[model samples]
Target: MQLTKGVEQAICIIVLLSTQDNHNPLASDTISEHLQVSPSYLKKIMRKLVVQNIIRSVPGNNGGFSLAKSPEQITLLEVVESMEGEISIYPDTGLINKVFRDGVHTSKGEAVLHDVFNGANSLLRDYLAKQTAADLLKRTMEQSEIPVLNWNITNPSNQNKKE
Candidate 1:
């Protein structure tokens, strides 16, 4: 259950946006520059985010992208789902049986197997739903022992200049 590259970048974008004051909108190029990702690819990802209403894209010279809602109002799962679709922990019974030493197949409508999948999905959904963007930004700041503004560590030339 790993997040896709786009999903991961979206979360990073969310966290960076969360750190910004006044929900200031940033252009795709600025974001791509900071993220070290291709601007064109990032534009596609941003489009998905915009369509999902997780972020809003503004047009015009002074316009860019901004959070549609506050960081606290945004859930990590929502951001993930927006890019990756719904999360489900489905079981591949044939694969499961082949890997197990006992070689017992659980593909034929087994009650226990259904329960296992349901339980796993439920737990993951609950966790993801509970983790909001606000929490992520806060945790990252605390763990790094750095100011929120430092999230812009991708300031390219500056990093090289430091060396």
Candidate 2:
């Protein structure tokens, strides 16, 4: 069960927001550059996040984006859902149909396999849903020995001038 690019980008955006100074909002262009993604694509993802209330946009001259709530309140599952709907690792239709149709297994064997796969899927979703963005952030901070650099300006010209 692999996560899509949209889902990965959403998580990265959330982590970036969590590391912000809190006083200043993050510009989408800046996030795009940092993540090495296209501005248009990132903007679309950002719109979904805004709609989900996962992040809020500030308009006009000092316009940018910020998390709608604290990191503790957000979950990775929520971020994923905001971008990709829901986390469906397994297809809804029973695997039994495939196995039985293919003659790979008997009907009875297929039924048992279906039950096992369904249970695993349920457990996976429950575990993922239970984890909050705050939990991930905490783990990251604890594990990292190196300090992260802060970029206050969005434009490279401004970033260069600062240096």
In terms of TM-score, the best-performing candidate is 1
TM-score of 1: 0.75
lDDT of 2 by residue, 90-144 (tens): 5646655665675656667766766777888677767778887777876866743
lDDT of 1 at 92: 53
lDDT of 1 by residue, 18-137 (tens): 665434567778888888899999988988988988888877885678888888888977888888888776745455555454534444435567788889888887898999887776
lDDT (C-alpha, whole model) for all candidates: 0.73, 0.75
Q: Which candidate wins on lDDT?
A: 2
Clashes of 1: 0
Worst 10 residues of 2 by lDDT: 154-163
Candidate 1 clashing pairs, residues 3+ apart or interchain: none
> Which sections of candidate 2 miss by over 4 Å?
92-118, 143-150, 153-163
